[model samples]
Target: MNSKDLKILNLFKFDENLLISYSINLLKIIIILILIKIIISIGSSVIQRFFNKQKQSKFGFNEKKADTLSELLKSILRYVMYFIGIMWILEVLGLSIKTVIAVTSVAGVAVGLGAQNFIKDVISGFFILFEDQFAVGDYVEIDGLSGFVETVGLRVTKLRDFSGDLHIIPNGSIVRVTNKSRGNMRALVDITISYEEDIDKAINIIKDVNEKMKKEFKEIIEGPNVLGVTNFSDYGATIRVVAKTEAMKQWGVEMELRKRIKHALDENHIALPIPKRIIMNYKKGETNGN
Candidate 1:
């Protein structure tokens, strides 16, 4: 072999004691990693079991809320387990636990100064969970975006909007949340009839249709009563119909209500306001002057 190659080999010549030490450290790290994976698996199962139990218990949270909390806790547990494992691994590499902590603490402070937004997000996430502002299945409007809550994380909240787009929003930016899934919603429809049509007759026809609608739509919680003439448009008087419905079913109830009312009016010969075209009969095309 060349002289340079011999020198490189001599520098790395095996020391039995040093080799054994490093091998032990490497084995210890592997064991630590394996234990971490096992513990995380067990931790996740426990969290799921606990939440599932809560779902059955009347005293605990409902299914949606329980699921949300369960997922969130699992995420936190994973982070904690990984942190502890990393610290242990560092100690196994001949670094003093105390020295490592001291170093991380200093480094953490430096990172913290530049990561104020991250801190705010975590704090806000905690409040979101504790205050019960909204849950994973809730339909909510936040930051002018409306959607169903998909997942809630420590740093971000995901929303799946009606258009199927997923929005990942930072928790800290959520100052106001409008939850639409909490209580009953309103289904409102404004129907305009021709000025020639009797308002009282139209009102009665709508009320009759709504009576049958109550039986068909289980979503309706309260009256789909006609509120009488609310306004006068260029074509007719606007009659408002309003009903209380189960949350998230308002639009369905509204569309159905309109359809039924329209048919009912049509059957009773109650004309609705619509554009009418005047056709002039002539041998050929006629001009406005003609």
Candidate 2:
């Protein structure tokens, strides 16, 4: 062997203690990682069991509240475990945690600046849950995105609109929320008739239809009674029909009410005005001569 090659081999052989130390450190890290997995598994199981028991208890929270609490617990436990595991791993590698902390502090500032939106998203999501602004099954309009909430998460809110579009919205972006899932909703339809037709007779026909509708639909919370003479024009007077219905059923009730009213009016010979226009013309050559 050349002199340089022999020297290199001797140097490595002389540093056997360092090599062994590194090997030991790596082995410890692996063991720590395995223990972390075990700990996390046990923690997760315990959390689930505790919540499950609470769910079964008569005095405990309801299903929705229980589920939300369980999810929060799981998230916190995961972060705690991961943080401790990383710290232990660094310690086993003979690294200075104090120095690492300082470095992380600087890194954290940079990350925080870059990830403000993510922080806002998490904060907003927590407020939403805590305030009970909306739930997973709620029909809501958030920042103009109208849909049924499919999932509420720490960073994002998922919604599935009526058109079958799935929207993944950052909770931070939702400033104004309109929840349509709660309480009763209003359904109004304007029915127009010929100006020549008797308003009272048309109103009577609508009232009869409303009476039949009330009996048919248990969802109608209030009258589908006609509001007289909502508007007037050369075409006709617009007769307004209004009802209060259970949430999400407003559209359905409105549609059915419209159909029924139309049928009733047609059957009763109620006239609907049609827009008419008159055209008058003079011969161009004759007019010029005049």
Candidate 3:
């Protein structure tokens, strides 16, 4: 062989042992990844079992508390496992774990300096869970956005509104929250009648309908009784009917009250007020005439 050809062959020389070593490392990595998956799956099931046991025990943990804790624990477990997996993969690639930690510590400080809001969000999220501010399936109004809470994560909270829109809100931004699912809600239905109608008769009719509704809808907790004349408008005098209903049932009860009252009033021939307008016409040289 020529000298140049020999040099080229030397440069291209293959190390079979080195290749074998690398193949083995690759296989080990694959095995590690598979094991991580299996371990995580098993760990998740174990965590669920633990919580389920807690729920059934005399510990007095409600379903909401159990569910919330389960989600948070699962999330923390997944993150820890992924972090360990990443470190192991780095080691397989012949990287120094101590050196990686030192570098990451420095980088983490730098990131922490710039990510104050992220830290705040995480802290607020923890407080939200601990304080029982609200839970999944609760209807709440936060910063004027009202919806059912879907998930409360470490960094964000998700809400699904009535129209099926999902809103993702940062935890730190939820300053004021109005929880509507905590107690009974008020259902108010105002019935207006003409000035000429017998006010007592209308009130009695509404009371009758209210009595019937109380039997029909078990959600009604308190009276749908007439509050007497609540308002006098140009169109009519308003007789307000107020009822206290179970949380989330108020709207439905209010709608049903309106329908029944309307039917009752129509059957009794109680005239609902109609709008009236007075028009005036004036000639150029004369005063106004109606």
Candidate 4:
């Protein structure tokens, strides 16, 4: 072959080798991804099984607590596996993990300064997990945002309020947390009755309803004491009933109590608040209408 043809042939071989190398790296990437998926699945299953065994064993973990911890562990496991798998794939593609880490370490100094909030979030996440301040599925109020805890990640905590708005809060910003699903919660129901009705009769009727509700709802933990005539509002006399219930059951108990009380008041002929109008049209010192 001539010199020009020889050069063309050598270039073709070089391109061929490069294509083969890239193809092999692509295959390795696919394999690494599959392995990561398998590992994550197995890890999650193991974590779930461990927590389930704890529930069945003498471990102090209740079912909800077990489930909560299991999910958090699975989250951590997935993140770790994905990170390792990514580094492995990068190495397969001829990017040395050590070199990448070394460069990242140098760049990290600058990145870390700007990412102080990120570091804080991760540190706060560890404290949150260790201290057992709250868990997944707990209804908590964090930083004025109240909702059921959805996902507690190392960087963020998610909350979906009743209006269906998702709030993604950085863990570092969480200063105070009001976990409503921890201990017994208070169920308070305020009912308004007419001023003309006999206050004592209404009070007795409400007390009887409360006693019946205590039997009906096993969620009730303590007395639903009736605080008679708690307020005299524009609506009427507001009677308050307060009870202690199983955590997260307070709202349900309050709703049921309100509904039953409403029906009971109706059955007992207790007059509820009614709007009265006295229209006086004085023409030459005479009242015309009521």
C-alpha RMSD values across all candidates:
4.4, 5.9, 4.0, 2.4
lDDT of each: 0.90, 0.85, 0.88, 0.87
The 10-residue segment with the lowest total lDDT in model 3: 281-290
Residues 251-273, model 1: lDDT tens digits: 99999999999999999999998
lDDT of 2 by residue, 1-290 (tens): 99999999999987997899889998999998899889888987897788789989999876656666666566667767888999998888776889779888889887986588878988998998899888766799998899988767777788899999999998898899999978999999999999888889989989998999999999999999777889988889999999999988999999998898889888988878888875545654332211
Listed in order, each prediction's TM-score against the native is 0.78, 0.69, 0.81, 0.89
Q: Give the TM-score of candidate 4.
A: 0.89
Once fitted onto the true fold, the runs of candidate 4 whose alpha carbons sit more than 4 angstroms away are 277-290
User: Residue-wise lDDT of candidate 3 within 115-184, one digit each (tens)?
Assistant: 7888898899999998999987789999999999887877888889999999999999999999998889
Candidate 3, overall lDDT? 0.88
- The Cα RMSD in angstroms, rounded to one decimal, for candidate 4 relative to the true structure is 2.4
Write candidate 4's Cα lDDT for 83-187 as tens digits.
899789878877787898998899988888657987898899888878988887889999899998887777778888999999999889999999889889999
Error of 4 at 258 (Å): 1.2
Give the Cα-based TM-score of candidate 3 against the true structure. Answer: 0.81
If candidate 1 were superposed on the true structure by all CA atoms, what would the RMSD be?
A: 4.4
Prediction 2 TM-score vs. true: 0.69
Top candidate when judged by lDDT against the true structure: 1
